[model samples]
Target: MGGGGGDGRSKELERLWAERDELDARIRLLESELETSSAAPASPAGEDAAAAGVGDGGCVGGGGACQARPGLAHADSLPADMIYRYSRHLLLPDFGVEGQRKLSRSSILVVGAGGLGSPVALYLAACGVGVLGIVDGDDVELNNLHRQIIHQEAYIGRSKVKSAADTCRAINSSIKVVEHHHTLKPNNALEVVRKYDIVVDATDNLPTRYMISDCCVLLNKPLISGAALGLEGQLTVYHHNGSPCYRCLFPNPPPVAACQRCSDSGVLGVVPGVIGCLQALEAIKVASDVGEPLSGRMLLFDALSARIRIVKIRGSSPACTICAENSVFTQEDFQKFDYETFTQSPMSDKTAPSLKLLPESARITCTEYKGLIDKGEPHVLLDVRPAHHFQIVSLSRSLNIPLSDLEEKLPMLETSMKETLDASAASDKQPSLYVVCRRGNDSQSAVQLLREKGFHSAKDIVGGLQSWAHDVDPDFPAY
Candidate 1:
């Protein structure tokens, strides 16, 4: 028994000795990465030497140290804390200390602080991009929390730029964060984009995308653009390495009806997260000169099917209006460009446009509808929302007929209206018809179609069920 106990103790001592050796090796590696080489200049005492001049485009390389800017005196090697913090990155064969140095010297401007901007800003800031600029004019809303992970519940009513900048700073105080609390527009696009090494197109509208890409082309800056809608997303790099600019591919904008916003057609929250991460990756690769960028290629992600495909896109066009070799699209021209007119879409697509297809007399207010309900008026309420949305919520005694299938279902709708009017025993009075949807926009079209089909009494409920939930019943579900 004594021999067995001695054997166990011997094994325990051996294990402890092995652990000590491993720890010693790790410590030595950490020290080697943190040490200032003899050829590099010594850093001043009691200073954050590693992060100096990073905000002013101070690059590093050639001699295993962060190179000083033209006039600034900076550190020779990474600080001990930073060496430990980025140890994983430092250990990478492809992206070693040199890559981190280059990344820390680059500045990036993210155009929107929404879903895509959330992850893009967060990763760039965490990865130690030197100067991170966030430009947005929007305030955080309750609905944005699902996909905009950078914002907190408490920041619901605050400016998105301020909220995102604060979060990025909280994640990495070593980097500099700039907040531009205004939307990018033709007047300021050139000025705002001129300072950054790379531009990220995280905005959600075609007008803004065109304006930004044009500005990038004018400024000779690389553009990493990403978009996510519904359960799908697409990403591409514009204006980099002979890649086509946005205008090169899309010479003409799509029809206004084809431009759908997430506010109209719902989007899966995580869809933007996947695309945003790739955008950040591409930006890092471009900044660090590490990997091949997504230039001249498009990445399509289908979230529902869990698939990602990269296809070759076209190169820069010689006859392209803005990016061709003989092109003369100057900054002055960009300043005078009418993006809204060209795209036929608003720069901010937060809500669907309210159509005035019917006169005021043909539209009934939600309060009037509530009065009709209270007085037991004889009217047929037709819900024209999509079938899936109709299943989400509907008022009692309302018939469901999606606007897409309205022409096919008109006969059924007429029968229901006839039954409602006949049941009221009003032989002389015309049948009362009301149409509703999630928003008031689609109901107007339904009313227009019904009126053309001889149902002149079909009046739209102004502001649709959304206004009904707000003005009629506070307990009704808004979504």
Candidate 2:
């Protein structure tokens, strides 16, 4: 009886080994079939649109064709383990296990590491996203710390992208972080965006924002965009299949006079943080395929009053140059388009003059003005700030001329000059006029206005009195 039992056990072991070998052979055969099938001929357009239908609407990779099987919906239904793992998401009818898995598998790319990028990167990383990519070419500075919170005090001189990446990784090790230590431009935008499923626009400048929108629309990828000025912030999801793109709304950037930049108008520290987090939420919604995303609507937030407003965006414009021909996707089409010319602000010469206008030639900073003053250079310094600011802080030998009162006050300067001329009985010398304001932006406009009125030797303080007070005399009071 013992001999018979031993023989039966040996036979059972042989059968199990035989079955394992057969399974290994089958796997190898399936891999070979996938390789051959993926190498099949491509369609004329270079994009494998035919391959788009594979794998139950999920992206298919390699040679094995994704076969649609019946009961796939049931297969995607919540399992015991999945339900337990994603219990929090399962509580919401809109976000079940399937939606959670979709989010877990999606990748997103965020451009810039400044104000808008900070909240977008932090929230996305903390939300269990599978992968996150950051692109930035700037270094952290003492001034940037006011709004850019991702970088710590120790990382003041470090690269912004690297510092941001470190913060994201520290939040979630499961998230794959890719850092690009360069600016995102036309030459590299498409290539960089192609690797990710979604793009988030956190860049401040107009050129980079336009480039990101165009690339996303062309590639048929979704983009979550946000921008802030003063206390107001704007948020939108652009380039989704059914939604209008960034160009569809604006068509072109606003005229220079109407355009407001952070440099010109100061932004509240928490304003961007509020707006950027909304952008991150929009991105997560797109990834999860759950709830109503901000695809066709713009959300505006006023931090000071705590108000939220929504603006609905209609379909794409028939005259849109970027989305009209779907011209943004292919490298050839993007190459043919002139981005530099496209992003250039409309010529301000054609528009009516405001309080002051900045000419195209001046590039002076406030630091330069202080040096000139210290050297006892024979130049006239004009304070273009409001009377309150001037009364609070004024440099020695500087004349108070508010930008708003410039036209009315010009005659007074001329009258004073005439008196000086009569007393001295000498010819009038062209006194070099240097303009300054709270920040350097308005001073440039003041200088340009002076030039238009025949003050040819006018100059602008680069960073205004703020830089002057910080660099020249720390004891001076700052407004």
Candidate 3:
């Protein structure tokens, strides 16, 4: 019986050895597979960053203290406080612990701290995004309070980034907030944009919008964009897997005359607030992979009618400079386009056919013009600004004939100037016909038009009313 037992044990040992040999072969195969994979061509850096656990979409590096982690990884690693804090997110069936985990790893960069940036920063921080970066170069001004609610009167004259970051921290202290207190210029935009998983285009500047779009397309990141003016606003996303970029929507920026800044065209406070909060919703959806993003859809909001409309936007354009194969906007191509110059107000574009072309005799500084106004000089100050602006502020003795209506309303100007002309004949001159507008540009344009109409004495007020408020009268109200 003892000898039989020994034989049985020996047979068992042999069987075990056979299994061990088979396991070793499997291990060798896996090692070979891993080696092959390691040797294969790597994916794009942005893709690699995301794959490495950066986030649903996040940049893993800008060469500082950032270590790229899989945003979706380590679902079991949540701290007790984290679990408690994110219990609301965890309660959702579609977005529970997994979604919370993704948000904890996600990073976002918001490119403005004004009206749109306010709600975006606030909501993203409250949602517990892992990292938040705010880029702005403006100071908190009195005018910002109406719609830029994140900034307070206490923060007036403070840097917008600092003020915004303070508000974000007050709402949620667990997240990291980075203050990029300078403007997002063309040169630094790509570098800054590549370091975040998602970018929020809260900027109103056209060049900055294109800059953000180009960088996101190049980096393979997502963009949540928003804009509001008057009673209307638009919200959309771009460069998220398959979608049209801004250039696909607008290949070229509108001419300066067609452009309307928030300052130039008054915006309803709720209009921007609505668009900004929607921007936050899109960003969170992107970060947590929760809902359908606005990649191929644009949300148009009409505050006047209180209606929201979602419309389909066309897909990528083959001719698109940034989103197409062999696209025109390469890393090198960005350098060729002058975003700095493009974003400046039309007054600064420098394409102005010499002020000299309008003639030195056809222009007067605000001081010289102020002197004529004070001396009761019989001159007709033709305020060629639009009717709306004329209503905002106007000289006591000026006529409002908008530039678009200037040619048609020549009779109105002639009738008004007849008295000045008759009085000037007694003094051997006519009340100098002076053209004025918000800035000096439209006034200059008006002066040229007048000259073409045989009213050669028409001269543009240098710097227009803005210069008037700045140089001539300290108390003259200016927008």
Q: What is the C-alpha RMSD of each candidate to the true structure, in Å?
A: 8.6, 11.3, 15.5
TM-score of 3: 0.80
**Top candidate when judged by lDDT against the true structure:** 1
User: Model 1, poorest ten-residue lDDT window?
Assistant: 55-64
Q: What TM-score quantifies how close candidate 2 is to the native fold?
A: 0.69
The TM-scores of all predictions, comma-separated, are 0.84, 0.69, 0.80
Candidate 2 Cα misplacement greater than 4 A, ranges: 1-87, 325-330, 345-380, 386-394, 411-434, 437-479
How much lDDT does candidate 3 score? Answer: 0.79
Window of ten residues with lowest summed lDDT in model 2: 52-61
Q: Considering only N, C-alpha and C atoms within 3 Å, which residue pairs clash in candidate 1?
A: none
Q: 1-479 in candidate 1: lDDT tens per residue? A: 78999999999999999999666545544433444242255343102223332422232221112222222323556545457667899899999888887787788999999999999999999887777899999999998999999999999899999999999978876677889999999998887887788999998898999999899998889999999999999999999988999999999999988887777788899999999999999999999899899999999999989999999999998889999989998888889999999988888855436778889999999999999999888989999999989998999999999999998889999899778877886756766899999879899999999888888899999999889999999999987
- TM-score for candidate 1: 0.84
How many clashing pairs does model 3 include? 7
lDDT of 2 at 34: 61
How much is the lDDT of residue 399 in candidate 3? 94
Instruction: Tell me the whole-model lDDT of each prediction, alpha carbons only.
Output: 0.84, 0.71, 0.79
lDDT of 2 by residue, 1-479 (tens): 78999999999999999998666545534643464366556443223222221112222222112212234346455323334444787687787666766665577889988898998899887765556789988888776788888989999889999999999978754456789998887778888888788899997666566778888877888999999989999988887857878888888776656666665556888898898888888998998887788878889898878999998889777778777764434667774666546766421111212333454355455666667767755556778888867887788867888898987798865564455445543345544577788767677777777778877777777667877888877887764
lDDT of 1 at 5: 98
